[model samples]
Target: MEENQLNPDVDYTDMLSICSQALDFYQQHGITELIHAFNIANILGTNQFYAEAAFFYKVAFNMHSKSAGQFPLAHFLLMARLVALLKGNFPIKEDEMNQLKGLCIPLYNFVEGWKRYKENGDALSAIRLMGNCFEEFHTGEEADTIYLTIMMDLFNPNPEICIKDRTFGAADFNVIPNNLFMYWDQNPPAEILQNFEYHKGLTHFNLKIFDKAEAIEWLYQNYGVEARQIFLSARHPAEAADFLRVHVINYYGGWWLDADIKIQSIDKFCSIIPSSYEHVFLLTHNNVVHNDFFGSVPNSPILNDCMLSLYRNSYLHTGLFIAYKTGPGIFGRALNRTFYRSLRGETKKPSVVLLNDRKFWSVIADFETPYKDSTPHWQAS
Candidate 1:
């Protein structure tokens, strides 16, 4: 297995091999090799290897359980508990939630709100409480200095959740930037083909479909060695997607549509929403915008900052890095920092249009998780 790039969608055999290697290191060196196992587990979970994530979380916890209450390990332990919730391990095996007895406001609200959501389907309530906590302790960093994911999944609140003054029609241009364009052989995953068919009908799109090789070449030729290295170093397909998606936009400057978008309604969404803002366009019903689908002009500051933040946070193994750095979370954070900085006269104002939700969305992950049928914890409205 490669040092990076663990998640492969076509099959998990490769990842399973990598996990075994990580486990080997732990077995050979004992607790000193804990972080390797922990980081690999995180990579597996991000790629939806829930069963593996559960197993590794247990292993890591056992290795460092004694030090869990100490300074840095506590934070990781709390996060481990949260991740356990994602894969169906509930009411957490331990009696305590996190090791930090002296809690911070955001951390307290986050843990409590998550419990509420888990107990009853209260996503909005949990989100609202978290939002309030953030407002109470707003830290305006270029990146989302405060990183948290209710789950590694993106929380693009359904459009019906809130009314908006403006909505979207068709985007200025048709473009689709995604991973694994030709990575698969003749037989790809059924889900991959389904997503492709859903949007390929929109023939006019400037589709920039890519596989691992194509993406690496594009990065090397266009952006340079560093970007290619970053893309190649990702521990999973999603991580590669996370890194490459931003680079494609930063270099080409166009709409980045998920393969699962319903292409049939693109024109209507674009036409109805008049072009009021130019450089970048984002949509949302909730305060936090999602990365499912968004557009930006070439080389915009938003995409640039996003790329930079991803590079800076590459070392972090937390869910926040997966969410913000390699996921849709960074896009909004970068935009917020740019906009807020302009407000404070720190930078020039960017021409960005914020539209009502449903401008573009991928229903595959819209409001669902693996535990959808067995539980009622995260039902969509």
Candidate 2:
């Protein structure tokens, strides 16, 4: 009969017969039956056919194991073993454990080789293989242990890795002090911090502004008086201001800039210009369109509330401000306490003195704008 003559409403038995014939024809054509069998096993497993699915999955896994190395086949075999164990058909054995351990040795070796190649800048092939490795073997505590071991080995180099390019190093990049102050609570990855510090640039650590009193003390003790000058901020306003005071008292006096404001370049603008107001800079609302960025200061009753109101009216950003040590005083402490209280929802109103009248904070810019090269800067509202 012509193929087009076949009825759409064919009976189940007729469909089964046709499918069986087609499968047999494919098998006779030397097509690998393993893939079909593996697919069938998955379908069966999905349909709760545990015993049948385990048998087919094992068949597929063994076929692959013989052709591919054990590492490449581990995922399929592991799944097969899991399914068998779930069905009570397979049990953990000494021989099976040995096989798994053997597989792991090569996987670790592979990862180490990749890491070495990556360090030497000859990692094209190794980098390509990393994805496969992660996908296949990211399982259980054994994998975790292997990863940790590899990382430890890589990082424990005697000479340590160095960047060949100096421009990307801390020296070339202009590190803003403001950025450092803002990220006071940001703890970057250890590797990142190490790289930055190796270049003698700004590095960061995250601390619970309220709870890290001991850590703060420890840092001071280890790094000495110079380390006390490193800028930091708290997640909450109250905590940040309090932390600032604590450091101020210890360091004698240092500047504290809110994180939200971004400076174009403090080194070029402030460092080069030597004036009596060198210690002080004019802060204006970011949205103020006046030719002078810093025109007038805002005097609001409730500082936080005024900040919120100014933010609402002139659309001025409230977070940008610089606080310098003008002889020891209670103003810093009071601001810190007020900020804390406002954050805790304790105060119905916020008391923010508008430093500038230009309507908005200057730091507001595109998300990807680079605030500083090597220096720490603020990223506030």
Candidate 3:
């Protein structure tokens, strides 16, 4: 709920006051700008005023859809409207619901498909409906994001579709390397170091910690200068970590744990992934795949997609939210693309396993990160 949202640079606290003033202006003089309407919706949405956000989002959508051709941003606003409606649990009018269902738009079709799934509890149908939307759109950015949002929403109602269990045998462990990696920018506090040592003691894997200098050098050596440059261009240390973790795991074929992450029971943790599994990661109760901790075999297609996402988003969206650019945004979209392709028999389904919250928390307890106050975390950044 504390997500940085579309643009964190906006001061929502000040915008909330401006939003009220604008509403008053609209009521009295009927003054409204298209950009203002969209900004109001974004502020309200980030503040969790979903019902009001939906109103402004609709206004923005209507304005853009009518004023011009089908620009992609207009569709994004439409998607936002549905998300606000869904998140707020606001009742849709019978006439509006009918209108949404009758529209030839792919987004509307997807929303109607979601409604059907809500009624019938058919997970595969909902997935296929989302897949159909993906097939229609060849572009990235907002289109891929719409797919990610829909996929996240679907996981909540049909939890069974998201969980993947991997029970590794003794022989299974031999194939996958026993390397565990974590990174810190520099000057790790004693508390963080203690946590690192504790995890190292618990697991048999060769735990490797990389400082900022070492991380940059490793990226340069393995991924070449372009990768190193991306790491340098990162606005924050954590963002740089996002770029590095995937590359390291993809090349080395092992586990990458965030510096803040602490494993509770090594026995339970080590038991999760089997040798045959190409990818292993944890999914939160909210259905986001955690980039903080994950494992993969060498040259995983999923991680390759993640690396590509980092480069593409860096070039295309210079200042996008880190989650969407280098974090779970790309992670979830890659999974959906892989899964959808698998459904069509276009490619082999990747051997991916997602540990649910129940399974994930059993071997790991959440700890207050030492740099919680000092570092600019994604939500605040």
Q: Which candidate is the best by TM-score?
A: 3
Superposed model 3: Cα runs more than 4 Å off: 1-32, 43-49, 62-72, 88-104, 132-175, 271-276
Model 2 regions lying over 4 Å from their true place: 1-183, 189-215, 218-238, 258-262, 271-274, 278-281, 284-381
How far is 212's C-alpha from truth in model 2 (Å)?
A: 4.0
lDDT per model vs. reference: 0.52, 0.34, 0.68
Better of 2 and 3 by lDDT: 3
By TM-score rank, best first, the candidates go: 3, 1, 2
All predictions: root-mean-square deviation over Cα? Answer: 12.8, 26.4, 6.8
Whole-structure CA lDDT of model 2: 0.34
TM-scores, in order shown? 0.50, 0.21, 0.77
lDDT of 1 at 286: 44
Error of 2 at 270 (Å): 2.4
Better of 1 and 2 by lDDT: 1
Candidate 1 structure, TM-score to reference: 0.50
Clashes of each: 11, 34, 0
On residues 48-92, what C-alpha lDDT tens digit does candidate 1 reach at each position? 666666556555555564553543364454455454554454445
Which 10 consecutive residues of model 1 have the lowest summed lDDT?
Answer: 134-143
